[model samples]
Target: MLKSLQNIFRIAELRQRILFTLMMLAVYRVGCHVPTPGVNGQVLASFFEGTQGTLLGMVSAFTGGALQRMTVFALGIMPYISASIILQLLTVVFEPVQRLSKEGEQGRKVITRWTRYGTVLLSVVQGAGIAVGLQSMNVAGDPVVPNQGIGFVILTVFTLTAGTAFIMWIGEQITERGIGNGISLIIFAGIIANMPSAIVNTIRLLRTGAMPPVTMIFILVLMVLVIMAIVFMERAQRRVPIHYAKRVVGMRNLGGQSSHLPLKINMSGVIPPIFASSIIMFPATVANFVHVEWVQKLAGMMTPSHWLYNVFFVAFIVFFCYFYTAVTFNPVDVAENVKNQGGYIPGVRPGKATSDYLDVVLSRLTFAGAIYVSVVCVLPTMLIGQLNVPFYFGGTSLLIVVGVGMDTASQIESHLISRSYEGFMRGASIKGRRG
Candidate 1:
């Protein structure tokens, strides 16, 4: 491990990328400390500290404690993600977006441009809502904001929107010049940045008898088991065989090859849990700030302890797994591409039959994926509800962390392969002893 660490710095390009990503992440963490205008940070912190085990706490954890601090980045990248999801759904429903979605590179650029615009618009609205919500929050019955006027609201909105935009820009820069998927890496950094503090907090709880030491050990063991399970499942896939018939071209034969199309069991990646959480939490988040009786009731029904919450949460994960997988990976298109390239799944016809074959395989994979997601996410809810444990290492958090880590590692490995350099695991082979 030490040798590998040293060797990373030996590669100048990789070292530069690593440093650039770190510098960008440091900039983000600094922004998380810059308090939003017209708010008492200490009072807000006290309020969040009181609600440590709630849904808000979980969201705040993803934001690297920014929400707890009520910082400029309190909103994090959620609005952009929500806007991106909305746009994808729009592509399914709207004619123009649907057409644009199929237009190849230029079309994708157009859609990405629209996504950026939508992100800003949503950020404005969400930032404004957050501003109003903070103004209404009275910590310990003392209003955190002295004057809840237009000035405070507008300033808060501008500050937070700009913060998100800044974050977005940093992510783009990292992707262009640094390494990995920049936005995801930023989020991964945010979640990881809080690990040391979470560990200390868990220890403090043990010391105070709020949580037993055995509980802490159990949490550690559970985390390792969960990570191992995730890695295994994430890597699992069904490789469907494809064969190309030998073709004649200008007195030469071409197009005969054998390959397999890798269809992942979890084709939707970490999207299902994210979509499920946002949808389930919408009402609860609203109820946190408002006094509407029906809304409050609806929200209460979805609280982690409620039977409705667990059932619907699992159902949503399942539903979105299929939904998102369909949106992102289209069987009809894949079949068309395969046919265009003179390739066909052996024993399957090249057009409609091939599409049907893929649809069936994808459906099975998606079902298993959904079950895996449901099982992983449900365990944390059960632990929190039944055992009253503060296992902040929830399935969603683990999914995001592990998924992003795997993706980034894959990209790094590809980089190594492209440059003819040995991979990250080259010298540290698991199946053999090091020299």
Candidate 2:
């Protein structure tokens, strides 16, 4: 492992990419401390402290506590993520988007342009909502927004929108010139930034007798086990064997090769959990702003520990697992491409039969993947509620951290292997091919 770390810096390009990513992430972290104008930072933090079990807590987690601090980056990259999910759904239902998606690089560029526009629109709306919401909130009669008016609202909106836009730009730049999926890395960095504090809090809990030493050990063991499960599941795949028929090309035999398509056990990656969480949190977030008995009741029922919340959360995760899988993978298209390359599944005939076979396999895999995702996400909630852990230790955060770590490490290994250098593992390396 130490050698691999040294090897990464041995390559100039990879080193630069890693350094650039670090620099951009540092910029983001610095921005997280820059508070938005007109907000009482101490009061806002106190309010969020009381909201650790609410949707606001979840949002703050994604933003690295920026929301708790009422920073300019309190909005974080969520608007961009929401915009992306919206555009993806639109591509499925809208003909123009679907057409543009099929148009290759140029078409993708057009769609990207539209997504950027959507991101800006979402930032504006969410920014305005947050600005308005802050004016109404108070921590022990101390207003979160001290001086509230049109000017404050406009300034707040502008600061938040601009912060989100800047974050979106950083993500794009990281993707182009740095490493990994820039958006995912940003979220990863945010979640990880709080780890040291969480660790210290856990230690303090132990010393204060709030949590028994045995319980802390159990939590640590459980975390390790869960992380291991995630690593195994993320790397698991169903390999469909493909055989290329022998062909005569200019009196020379060609095309006699065999390969297998690797369909990931979790084809949708972390999208389902993210999408499900966003859907489940929307109502709770609105409820925080609205002052009504019924709305408060609904919000209470939707708290992280509530049975209704878990039921809906699991359902949404499953629904999105299948939905996102369908959006990303097309059996008919894969079958067509395979046929064009003179390859066929061993037992399945070409054309419709092949497509049908692929679809059935994918459907089964997606169902299993949904079950895995639900278990991973819900188990942490159960643990936290029952054990009263001091900080967010698992669930969606764990999944994203492990998933992105695996992907980034795999990419690094690929670069080393391509350069004829030994990967982290001796004589073995992480595989990149997946269908």
Candidate 3:
């Protein structure tokens, strides 16, 4: 590992990309501390100090406590994520979006433009809602705002929305010039940035007997094991055989070979948990702003500790697992392209039968993937995080960090090998072919 890292800096371009990614992440962290105007961050922090069971609290875990701080980046990259999910859903439910999704490069550009617009729109709406809502916030006996009203709200809305736009731009630049999937890296960075503080808090709790020392050690051990399990599951996949007919191309042979499509064990990645979080959190967020007693009660009912919450979370993850995989990986398209190239799934017929075979295999694979996601998500989330021990299992947080780290490392290793240098695993150099 040390030798491979030494070789990494030897490659000028790879080193620059790594440094650029770090710089952008540093900028994001700095933004997380730059509080939005018209809010008392001390009061905000106090209000959220020990409130870890709520949905907002869970989201705060991922955003690196930026939301509670009311930072310029209070919204984080959630608006962009939501916009992306909206576009994906539209591709399934709307003809225009479906057409654009099929238009190749031009269609992709059009959809990307729309997603950007949606990101801006969502940012503005969230900013405005937060601005209006801040007036109602209080900590202890003090109101969180304790200042002028409408003018402050407008200024805050504009500032936060602009901040989100800036974050979106930063993520785009990172993707274009740096490393990994940019938005995922940003979220992963945030979660990782909080680790030192979390560690210190755990130590303090142990010293002060706030938590038993043994429990802290147990938690530490569990974290290590969970991390390893995550890595193992992330790399697991099922390869489906694809065979092509022998072709004679102008007195020479061209296409007579076999390959396999690798269906990953976690096909949806961290998207399912993120989607589940948003759906579960949004209602609780609105309830926080609403003053009705029953509304407040209903919001409490949506808290992560609730049985319904876990049940719905798992169900939603499974639904999205199949739904997103179907949208992102189309069996019909795969079958059609394969047939066009005189390819078949060995014993299966070329067209419709191939599609059906793929559908069946994918369905079974998706079920396995869904089960894995549910176990990973629920074990840490519902079981461990409920202890109120100041330990942030942040299951999705860990998943994104691990998954994105592996991917970025794989990319860097590819770069090293492309230059004929050794990768970290030496003889076991990892690779990812196009899906």
Reference-based TM-score of each model:
0.91, 0.95, 0.93
Model 2, range 251-295, lDDT digits (tens) per residue?
699998999999998999988888777777666776878778998
Q: For model 1, name the residue pairs that clash.
A: none
Q: Give the per-residue lDDT of model 1 (tens digit) for 69-168.
A: 8898987877777777888888888999999988999998998888788778878987877777778888668887877889999999899899888888
**lDDT of the candidates, in the order given:** 0.82, 0.87, 0.82
lDDT score of model 3?
0.82
- Report the C-alpha displacement of residue 421, candidate 3, in angstroms: 9.1
- Cand. 2 Cα-lDDT: 0.87
Superposed model 2: Cα runs more than 4 Å off: 421-435
Clashes (N, CA, C under 3 Å) per candidate: 0, 0, 0
Error of 3 at 49 (Å): 1.2
Per-prediction CA RMSD (Å) = 5.8, 5.0, 5.0
Stretches of model 1 off by over 4 angstroms after superposition: 421-435
Rank the models by TM-score, top first: 2, 3, 1
Worst 10 residues of 3 by lDDT: 421-430
**Which stretch of 10 consecutive residues in model 1 shows the poorest summed lDDT?**
416-425
Determine the C-alpha RMSD for candidate 1 after optimal superposition of all C-alphas.
5.8
